[model samples]
Target: MTETPFKISIPDEKIALLRQKLELTTFPDELEDSGWEYGVPLSDVQRLVARWANGYDWKKHESQLNSELPQFTRDIDAEGHGTLSIHYVHKKSEIAAALPLLFIHGWPGSFLEARKLLPLVTKGSDNFPAFHFVAMSIPGYGFSQSPRTKGFDLAQYAEVANKLMLALGYTEYVTQGGDWGFPITCRIAQIYGGKHSKAWHTNMPIGEAPKSTTEPSLTEKEKAGLERTSWFHRFGGGYLRQQSTQPQTLGYSLSDSPAGLLAWIYEKLVNWSDSYQWEDDEVLTWLSIYWFSRGGPTASLRIYFEAGNHSLGAAFSVPEPRPTIPLGLSQFPKDILVYPKNWTREMGNVVFDADHESGGHFAAYERPEYLADDLRKMFGKGGPAFGVVSGHSGYA
Candidate 1:
């Protein structure tokens, strides 16, 4: 691994240009019925744009981000294949005793996905100083060089992320992810189980979907959960279809305009945020991370071109289970798709499965206090850390 000479300083000119573009954005005329049907709600977006154009302060958010986290880039050259460049930030916490925790964000989510809640996960006052926080931007997202090719599925991402962790000199660490982060963490646990992979955790894991054959009998509560899951896929999967088939076209629209990018992302923010009334300060704080990194477009579309290509239909196999390593599952209520405890039990040791009373798909973002504390307990117990655990198990 080579050190990539890089910094998180976004030039003043770029910030000014972004604001200018936001100010100049012209909304396309749409019928009342057409509002938000095609994408983000026109009226809601206008409100957000108005605030972004006139009230959002990028420099303030910039200063806060720089002070809270130190950002840098590293290049990992895989044997003879090539080098992959990544951007990462480590929160400056005084607790050297904190367990090493690696956080991975999902599609349309930059490293800043944890921005509002980093302190909750790493600081002392909330509960405990439990983790040495390491946050990273996925390739082609934010400062990290976007993947030059397609097929950057969870397995591929896990490979690169593990390399990145090794490059950072963390022999053992605990990993937590949501959305794409969940699948990526799963691959790491599967491929690098035991001493090399250690223990890992996830919030929104994509486990094997229920088979379509004759209805396997489900308990009453299980049946309710399945019904809810089915409803979400039927109603909300339109976005997935577009993401899988025509990401390039979607990329063109999102990448071209600051307003377009903000609306595209803000939908998830508002919908998934535990706090439904997303304040201006909170909303722009996140948008600024993308705007400064100019990651809004590249990261959003990468998932479409990368994971959409394959792995969606691959048969679900218990990721080469490692008996020695422990796995933690922190399931949140509002998550659209969830893996039952029985499903995760097949892959590895289930140390902890806590179904929280609150929060949604973005657990870390929505309930960092709960997420971080749970992770702290898992790490402090010393069962396993990261995807790599101690000792050779069959999984590794």
Candidate 2:
């Protein structure tokens, strides 16, 4: 595998085309009193579309992103999946002994999610630890190349990530992720635990309900968590069913219509978080990444299908074996599937856990400081997983 530095330079013609499409957009009618109960409000979409066409400066945000993230591309060889060109943000810490940390993003999110914590995790003080961070654009999302053939399941995503870290000399490293990231990083720990992959952390915890026969009884909080999970599956899971079962069928609309792409993702950004206020420009910038992604916006939705279905197709799930390495978790109250501490013990060798008073699905992006602090406490000098990675103590 070879790595080359990458820069964002979306062609001028693409920008012109986006403007033309925005100008010709035709909107639908909304109920007089309907707001979020129905979906993202029509007012919100109108404002965003106007800004995207006239006011939002893509070049300004594009340049800012390029300057903030030290981007790169590497061709990783995933077994049986052939060679894939991967894009990532690799920011090494000045702390010579900083630990290597791999950050992964989920659906509707890009490597841009890791932007805020890049500076926070680069140095440690007062018993807190620092790290050498590497956040990858999980293939088929962002700028990374998509899989050409089918049957690329959870294990393959893990393989690409593990190999990328090894290519960057990160034979041993810790990880942080949520959403789709939750499962992918877990796969990494299962595949490379006790050897190359060290401790892992996540904000989203998903699992089957604890049956009275096999698992322990659920507490009030755990019961509520189960209800939340159920709520997601009942109302919020329409996208999951489509993406997991027939992603290509829905891809046609997202790929052909830019407005359709915006609405498809913009809804998640609004509802998935804990009432985080989003500026129009901010929304447009995120939307732009998907609209201009390497294989188009729909490419990202297939992970749900591939992961849910077995390696062959009918059964849903690739292997999710428990890892025996030290594991840490950060519980955000408003996260989509918030689970109790006891429930997550089923994940792996549990070491440390933190419960936040606030925050939602996008913990790293919505509450970066809190997430970074939790990580420091988990791997600091007197921390449970401290010195988990050999030679990288994350100290000055």
Against the true structure, candidate 1 reaches a TM-score of 0.83
Point out where model 2 deviates above 4 Å: 212-224, 310-320
TM-score to true structure, per model: 0.83, 0.95
> For candidate 1, lDDT tens digit of each residue in 1-396?
665544466777877888788889999766778754566678877887888878877777777777766777888654333676778877645655555567888766778777755776666533333456778787667777666655666667777788877777666666788777766777777776664566778776445644657645655655555665685677656667676667777777776687887887787776554555667677776766666654456555656555635334331234444435677877775676755556545556777777776777777767777887777556544433322333211110
Worst 10 residues of 1 by lDDT: 387-396
lDDT of 2: 0.84
Q: In each prediction, how many residue pairs overlap at the backbone (N, C-alpha, C within less than 3 A)? A: 15, 1
What are the lDDT figures for the candidates, one per model?
Answer: 0.66, 0.84
